[model samples]
Target: MTFAVAMYNLYDKPISNVKVVKTIPDDFSDPVIRETTEGRGEVEDNKIVWTIDKLIPEETVLMKFTCSIMVTDITKRRTGPIEVTYKANSSFAGGLAIDKYDAYTRNKFYVDTVERDEEPGVWDCKLVFENPSEFILQLFNADVYSPEDESEKFVDIDPKDVSLLPAGAQWHSNKWRYESEELPAFRKKLEFRVMPDFQTNVNGTISISDVILEIASITGGMSYDLTQVPTYKEQDVIAKLKIINNGSAPLNEIAINQQYFTSEFNPPNASEVTMIWDGDEVDLPSNSVKFDSNVFRISLKNLRNSDTGLFMPESILEFEYPIHCVNPVKEATFESEITYLANTFPLSQELEFRPEVPIIEALHLRRKFRIGKEVIPIGALGKYQIILTLENIGTAPLQNVVLMDKVPDNFEYGSYSGGKPQITDEVGEDTLKWTIDLLNADDKVEISYEISGTGEYSPSDAQLGL
Candidate 1:
């Protein structure tokens, strides 16, 4: 019978010559087929030798061997295979003996490098398998690590969905699940079949040493520095700053500096000037933040009209934000258009008109009087009285105010007892007239005339024939 032997290190350190021997029945011809020793590494002659025993036909012969002889240092771990076979006899078939081996199994490995997402967050990890031989490999369980006081869970990566790289071949499954509530202080272990398939008796096991898992979480948000931008000055044109948060977490008790400033209407220069904010401080909302919310308003009562000597109002105004925000608050801007006119001119000057101080316009009679109801009886002289009220809403009093009323064609002119009567129309069109001596501010004059029925006639009748 022939013998085959293999030797290798579990930790990947290389191993040199390993001895092998086999005993056969005396009837078997002393190892026929000529070839004595063969292997992958350096081998000396007589490494595998057999002695003959002619006396005993059935006695078993022992094959002596001494093999630990390679001349290199075995610090690094390695492994290789060895095979032995017996020459086939006429009656029996040749037998092959083989054993898988490794030189080192307990060598330690470390994480060489680590990479994280540009936008901070936890991400999954991957391992590469390079071992070409079929071997058994094991990993340190996640639960075995520290901070595992909590529950543990894991999910296997689905091969159908995950893309497999070169490392995919040496694994039974492309990915496996490993999770533990405990904090990961130590490296985790992962084990797998050295060879992807068992049908082929391949040699060494390849593994990703000390695999690491990552945790995902929100770090800090964007920040704003105030020292870069200083306080705003009066009359200085400035741009607003903006703060934005697109993340899931909300900020707390945020507030911007109160000393922010923007341009305001200036009376002395008759132009838009900067106005620093000195208003009370304000706090931001818990959930929502306004993109263009107004923080403060600058009064524009100072601008005056240069040519018209009137206060010129600013209809459209632009405002800017402060340098620093409570958090890194984004600067916001807004434009306001007032409903009513604030000032008459754009130049800085004196006040031209103040409606509240009794400034009046004109004193012409707004409307004349004709006192007759819709159903004034046809011919019966419907006794009617007409009244007139004259008002002086101007800045000064009105004098020589004369009130007059014309009598309808069917009525007769009446005598005026209140004032001297002046009749301009000869056909008796004048019914009444009055002259008020004087009408002061917010003052008015009232006068009335008397009339009687003349005769009965339908409204459609052209004239009354007395």
Candidate 2:
């Protein structure tokens, strides 16, 4: 087969309004290549032109040129999209020649063309050349594989590991067993691009969406009480992570692998407490995550006084996780704090009742008595009546009483008329005692005593001295 090359200007014309101001080099043989314009041009003039080269031999050839144009609205202060397509006839057979066996030659065929439109937004470009001969056709794009950092391809992360993503496109590998016509053979590479404009949109839309590798959080820390720093009940604290959506697209299924440690806990009710989560892997939400301040909680029992739990005050939590950046998985490490909590009670119970006096009272008493003119002679038998009155003078009632008096030598016992009294006590000192069973908080009791004495003497001479 003979090879003949020809150049065609998509943005150019032979006559007036349309013309190809730019062209690819004639010596260039690559079917898929990138060429930039020296300067921008107005649409009316169509100054910029894309040059096409024909590498196949034939009578007539067809070429497809595609690119996205970005249009700026100076008044609106924003950019839009406009896609451009150019097809022209060439004096050759088929299109550009591509070597199927060469990986480098085939990869150079992928290209993404962009443009701005006045009405809509930017137009994304995907150019497909249908008219194919024996030669292969392809597109050219930037290399997805990084030569400097090989570790950027695969990584392992623990549960507590949290990764902050950079602004750009992010991708993670998914095992797809199915086959497709576009890619007849399986390709292992995952491609991602972080465009600045796309990053700006993500930052504006998301609050704190980022990648997170959550292991577990802690509610209690190292604390001491009267006992041997009683270990708190082991509670599974929700591991929280902070992630920033720095990329153009959201990240999903951020796998966090956590190596959980067996915990020792001292419960207030018992001596030991512990718990475990069944799985080693956890999946994060769809959005790019931000910082999470919540704690993952776990129930524990049989806590001990001398032991510690997986999450405790001042406890250190460390783990790793796989990260998605620029479409590949990388390893990231996360470190956090775990805390513990202790309970307490009062030493004494509350009082219900107390003993106390309700009330008190005081009493004062004075009396005077006189003898009337009715005596016959000294030592004469005579009957007389004595009047007496009583009053309440104390807080309590008095009962079971008896009356007694120390009469003079001329006095004798007379029949007294009133309520009878019962004597309760009599002492050798000639004193009498009375007892009363009924008493109130502030009530009083009263009693009286009476006696009579007589002597045969005139008023001037009191009774004979005795």
**Model 1 lDDT tens row, 1-466:** 2222222223222222223323222222333333323332223332333322121223223332322323132122222222332211122212443457444333223222222445233323334333332343432222222234333323233334433323222332223323333322333444332222122222322221321111111111112222221112222223332222212222221122112222321111212222222232222222222222333322333223222122111111222333221111123221222111122222211111111111111122333322222222333446554444566766455677666555555555454445556766543545345567777767655554545545652333212110
RMSD of model 2 against the true structure: 35.0
User: Which TM-score value belongs to model 2?
Assistant: 0.18
Which segments of candidate 1 are over 4 A away from where they belong? 1-381, 413-417, 426-428, 456-466
- In angstroms, the error of model 2 at 4 is 88
- lDDT at residue 377 of model 1 (Cα atoms): 32
RMSD in Å for all candidates: 38.1, 35.0
Cα-based lDDT for every prediction = 0.31, 0.26
| lDDT: worst 10-residue window of model 1 | 211-220
For candidate 2, write residues 1-466 as lDDT tens digits.
0111223233222211222232222222223323222212322222223332322223222233223322232121111112233333332433445344322211212323334344243433332212122223221121222234555322222323322223221222222122222322211232222212111111011111221212121221121111111122222222232222122221221122122122221111111112222222333222312223232222222223213322232222222222111111112111223333221111111111111211111122122222122222333334333333233344334443333322233444344344344433233222323344443434434433333445752232212111
Best-matching candidate per lDDT: 1
